[model samples]
Target chain A: MPKESDDLSTLGELGESAVLGRIFPRLPAASAQLLGPGDDAAVVAAADGRFVVTTDLMVHGPDFRLAWSLPHDLGWKAAASNLSDVAAMGAVPTALVVAIAAPADSPISLLEGIADGFRDACGALAPGCGIVGGDLSVSDTLTIAVTAFGDLAGRPPVLRSGARPGDVVAVSGALGEAAAGLRVLFAEALDANGAPDAVLASLVRDRTTAQLTPSPPIADGPLAASAGATSMVDLSDGLAIDASRVARASGVRIDFDRGALGADPDLALGGGEDHSLLATFPPGARLPGGFRPIGTVVAPADDEGNVSVILLDGKPYTVSGWDPYTGWKDSGVAGGSAG
Target chain B: MPKESDDLSTLGELGESAVLGRIFPRLPAASAQLLGPGDDAAVVAAADGRFVVTTDLMVHGPDFRLAWSLPHDLGWKAAASNLSDVAAMGAVPTALVVAIAAPADSPISLLEGIADGFRDACGALAPGCGIVGGDLSVSDTLTIAVTAFGDLAGRPPVLRSGARPGDVVAVSGALGEAAAGLRVLFAEALDANGAPDAVLASLVRDRTTAQLTPSPPIADGPLAASAGATSMVDLSDGLAIDASRVARASGVRIDFDRGALGADPDLALGGGEDHSLLATFPPGARLPGGFRPIGTVVAPADDEGNVSVILLDGKPYTVSGWDPYTGWKDSGVAGGSAG
Candidate 1:
């Protein structure tokens, strides 16, 4: 829990306007915003006459536990996750509209910290991209829902279905670090009875930071698009699963060279939440900076049913990605709180 | 609880992909969509080089009760609420990106009904505006967060601060009906102990329907803009409070003729969630067909503090708007479930 301060008030004490007043100043201003908060809606410049949009939700129980994530980390992760989606469309993020629902007793400092995180994340990851507007509600669960918008800059969107048989699959940003971080957190968080212990903090800071606040290569998306990437996807649900998505969409099979994947290839293949850019470039084409060759697209086998096929060193890789519902039950976290 | 059927499997039974497969077919197609769902993000056309964006959250406890709100009603109300913000900007809604977080055991039919609600709401309220993309997550509380986008269509956005002294205050769509409906629902929902029984339906079907499924005059917004509305606001809050917002924003005091507010002016002044469009037109300007004049804006009084001033037939109207945090406690509706 956040340290209680006499200066800090709770949402229950300070009404919506007062809470927003405290947060708005901490947020970064959007370059594309024509109108910001305090209105019914915000107007953003979609300079290219088309904009890419996506939304993602981070809920308290399933997505993150307050014990594991600070308010700042929650905001950073939420913004980074949604921003990665906008980048995956091969678009430069322009603005974000965030909606948060938290318990009435949540401190004003929590929201202020969230706003600061949004400011810093946008400043670091995608300069000029900032929060345009937001809404707040009182709820039992702390839910953060963000919708990000991006400007394509007149380039055609690079889609998952556009890959061909001979394309080389490349990935930008770290693959397995985030999942490794999650493991570190879980191991440290669990008590003797295997239930989560809220008091514990992960000793592995780097891996924990990667899991908590990932910095996806936002610029690499448009760079790959400019370099004529045939297909692209954000590595949100592990390399193997996301690669299969591209392969299935493109009617091909992906074969990964185990050596090409960094030192822990198994973790790279099965771990999730890296938010890396995975793009397929034509053979012999110049790979964009930050992207490393990971796999190759091949024709689907005739006898095998038309299903997602992923191969690791010429053998079928059967490991799957994260699924929230099943994962929640499988993890045995039990409830919303450790207490 | 929704009726159980052999075909209606729960979300836990069918993973995200299968659940999405069921919902995708039921959602309406967006005319402004360049690329739709199933991608990392959706691309939407912003023909005039700008788009209006807004987000809202509807959570289970403070926002609605599942006992009273059917899945379809939840979906319809959520869409209508967000769409009204887009309309309030004097823009035509083009697309929505929705993110929903529900318990793992939630029925797939609940999602299907929500999808159907989105389809029907878009069909009736804002034709051609549909769900372009969405995300799903598992949570203890069922939360629906919607971000709506609208095309400006080459018109200057009508802002809340644009109203000038001598402007005629006008409104389109009925006020207080939704709040009245809430009152009806509360009366019927409470048992002998004054706790929510969650069994009885409101006797006043029209009022309950009004509260559950509102049809705000969306088209009148642009019409009012075309007829030269100086300022505009969506009346999700009570008329007195929303008018106060306009009064405060424009640095003007609004004097409303109580008789102009249909029967039960007190209800009109204090009730909320009607989602009506409240606009100001310059004196002698032609009021749009559906808009009825309710009040007039005047210069701020020299003696009164520089705060929101709203007069109901010359006396100060002290009733405040809804604050979710305070209202959640004030209503005495404890816990997520009635049980």
Candidate 2:
């Protein structure tokens, strides 16, 4: 076997079992978890007698890079991505299964770091959400896939299709922080030597932390469901795009107040991976705490089978949100246009 | 952006969404599935109101390779690995989520093939179990991570630690086929130019198929459970190793009839990835069809917690099973003594 020092930067630094050991200790115990890591499978309690499931994968390079993230960051990000999906449905995350592929020659410390990352995210974001079980295999590159399970606690799940035309649009948590963080990380002017130490540290911290590991507003999701939110989604593909999904699913148009969105419009409209809860409520329904009103669901315009995002002044925004199929580029925002 | 002929053989050849599209259609539709693939996450109906979850990762090189297997095989293997865990619990598979990492230069056709592999495996073994959601990203090598969910149908789950002395040891399905197949694939003699077409085809087929895609006996697992088997496990790490686990957990020593292990003893004892079901039953319990009596559970002779597997004439076979931490060669029959 190669010495850890020889490839400490790679995932081979830590062995799979050792990596799991590091993360397992940090996880909180959940009542719903019948079995946690170290078994063939995890047994979780389904209080409502139904389980909610979601999965997401993170690959080194396209999704992330070693130069931009630490192993722990990657782990945290992997867990958060799936956990957020569970949260999107107003479900309580119960357990997570992680499968990681890395090169044999990669340092084992990288795997340890990745496990730590996953544990850290699950620890803080969804306490008691243990790493139930997973598989490890050697690969040419680093890849982490996480599957998360959640419980509905016997309540009907709040889906994106539940929003009605008269529903009030609202959001929990700030938008664009992750996107802004990414921007600062990629900004040429913020290089280590050129930028102020404090500013650079803060920027790097936010950028690397948020970009590498997202913090999903899981707590607010169940609260929204309790507050009778009509429809909801986790803002992964920017607000405009995801909100459009809700609008189209509910057969309604959504109108957003530019003032309510953060100072950066791109963060609200074009930013991806924030994982904030975007929800809608009946006009008179009780709203959850920390939820800020952002927009309103409205009747569709002349376009058939389409959901458009109108601006504060009742004009449509010409620029659509991010599309994975189409390359991303800067575009001027316009009023009264369909996305 | 690269053409198919550009030699990029990486994951980029298959776009992430496109890969999902191929596998989504081939899965069996389960009534427990509230939503199938093509969404942010799949919602599965947990019949007992709970779920059994597990995950496994397949990485190129350590787990598989392009030279030895095709992309489709990797997909099937990844899904099967996790599905085996769910089966180990005597649960019915409900849904699956996959995370794939590949190089950008890979041909899209390879991704489609991988998806097809997943579909094929699910169709044959886990009908109604589909890849409901997944993430795709570029990496240096091909990595597949699959998370599987299962429903228990309200039966008390059979755990590994429930065995007792005097319990009859039995197995469902074939043993050692995968390990034997692997050996055939690696043997130099089999690669000779003038090898018989039928024999060579069977050998190659067994080796290639077993190595690339292991079919876990999911059906037989629940069957054993319904038959009142005391303790059960999936033959993932090999019979001796996994049986020892049952012995240790149940606080009993297990003795096996070497002659009854089938035509090949090595295949039965130390073969890994056969994905057969091993269970312990009461002495007078009626054994289910397809279940072959192999041994008897007895009290541990020593305090070391070592479970002995004796021969038919009462001779001790000291060889243990495979351990991931240890090299595969050391755990084989030829290299080590049976315990």
Candidate 3:
């Protein structure tokens, strides 16, 4: 465990070279990375004549709050957001490169904490995964830009537009926990008192910890693909929006049985930032391990002529989560206000 | 031309999806990209068993300025910076992914201009190299995070630690132009007038244009490797500092002859952001195309025992450029001011 000692040492005080030296050794070595950091660029093992690539940016104010999230949590969240996209593509996560810009006076401990989180998350979440290379710069607001690369291993990528009518929509992990956690965190933050009482904190479920340290089922992506999943997406945004995306792409309607989600059905529909995989499998197809059926894809209804892309319990789902553009500046972070 | 008629259509006014729609069509398509943007992740072709990967972040205020640099220039410069590293690794540039976050009030035209610049740069400098996928978010500052991937063909990667005693040191492209350009840009920015006279602008050579839009000799890295080049590095910093890094890695010294270089020898040695390739080849080895001898690698000196990794005119060279640790705020951009 990195000592949570709040040292005042700043990255500027420790030169760029020295700061790199401090974090490089902490990174785990991966067999998939042919050449690691310190080179002009890193060399990662590829497969199937093609590779899957994706990138995401996490800014300090909009994506996260430094007050509630530790440097370690921020690092884990950044990796989780990007890695989940790779998993959503039905590929096995292989390598990641991060470019971070931070205020000059920021603590060196922030970087050290982030590095620890990066190593630990990869080790626990996707065992052979590792960060290959990265760049560090100086800026007023903290920003982390991560690009994750994955190997398809001879499988065709499961795209959002592949779902057909009668396909069963399933999920590889629990949903709405992140949004719940965000709500709780924000409520406590607004209280002006420190974190809530220990009793209340203990009541928060472990799965809800996704808001801080998401552990998406990355391996399940390839499993789902091999099992013949027709389409897929990462539930980074709320279910209503993400499912609507697939509905629009595939020209269908996603009907979700909210009551079947157990309690707090709105969490499954309106909550966001869970980073779980939402996929559709053909009827009678072998279901992948770690996946549970949540909904179904059907032909659009023509009764009203203007059909809704997503529905809840057979009716149009009116609520939505996290629309960055429509939301005001003072609104909540990336996932927006939770259900 | 991207219709420079900026109507000031803010990103907020256009909405997120609309902004993406505007830029997506403007991006050039590439054969190397098996699955392009609009997907959860992009699939890039990498014939070799391994691929080279790297990332960089360009932040506004410190890395760039809205007052001087247009959005198109920012996009081109971001692409150039990361792609140059790919070339420095002796690999053919293949694909790029960019994640940009900006203030809500920023104009949609900025993104369009950036996309145009990205397409033009890849088309001109490296055909088949184009952005494959990306993410966007809202933030107070404008930031562009670029991650580039490349194929190494069948050649081995040339590392900085491979230089041996008596190796012939050479440069694949011009040096010092970027630093000179930065100096000129800063001087012009400080002028009471927006820009200087046409004569003064012409006096700023084409090489200085590199500071804003660097065009490094990326193809030279692999050529040098195939030609039996022993060691190599990218001169994103000054030649002297970059040479020092090579010498430190190889445990040797590099001697630069001032007389061999034309007038303004300091530009060749002390200027930074050139993005040129500095490499050492075996003595009497056939030099590759686009390379010219600049210095020689030699044994570590033991007479006085005071070591300098890089030497000029057979004497220890002392001048340096862009030491982030030593500089204060209000210095040049591009990792300029830090500790």
lDDT of 2 by residue, B102-127 (tens): 65666765666677777778878878
**Model 3 C-alpha lDDT per residue in residues B188-230, reported as the tens digit of each score:** 5444665434444445535346777777777787788788888
Q: Share of real interface contacts recovered by each model?
A: 0.88, 0.65, 0.71
Worst 10 residues of 2 chain A by lDDT: A327-336
lDDT of each: 0.84, 0.69, 0.79
Which docking category, incorrect, acceptable, medium or high, applies to candidate 1? high
DockQ of each: 0.81, 0.45, 0.63
Tens-place lDDT per residue, model 1, B257-330, is 88898898878877788889999999999898689999998889887664448887776767565787767745
lDDT for residue B22 in candidate 1, whole number 0-100: 84
Task: Give the lowest summed-lDDT range of ten residues in model 2 chain B.
Answer: B1-10
For model 3, how big is the iRMS in angstroms?
Answer: 1.7
Clashing pairs in 1: none
lDDT of 1 at B229: 94
Q: For model 3, what is the C-alpha lDDT against the true structure?
A: 0.79
How well does candidate 2 match the true structure in TM-score terms? 0.85
Scored by lDDT, the top model is 1
Pairs of residues clashing in candidate 3:
none
Q: Give TM per candidate.
A: 0.95, 0.85, 0.92
Model 3's DockQ score: 0.63
What's the CA error at residue A288 for candidate 1, in Å?
1.0
Off-target runs (Cα >4 Å) in candidate 2 are A1-23, A105-109, A188-203, A206-208, A305-313, A318-339, B1-23, B188-203, B303-336
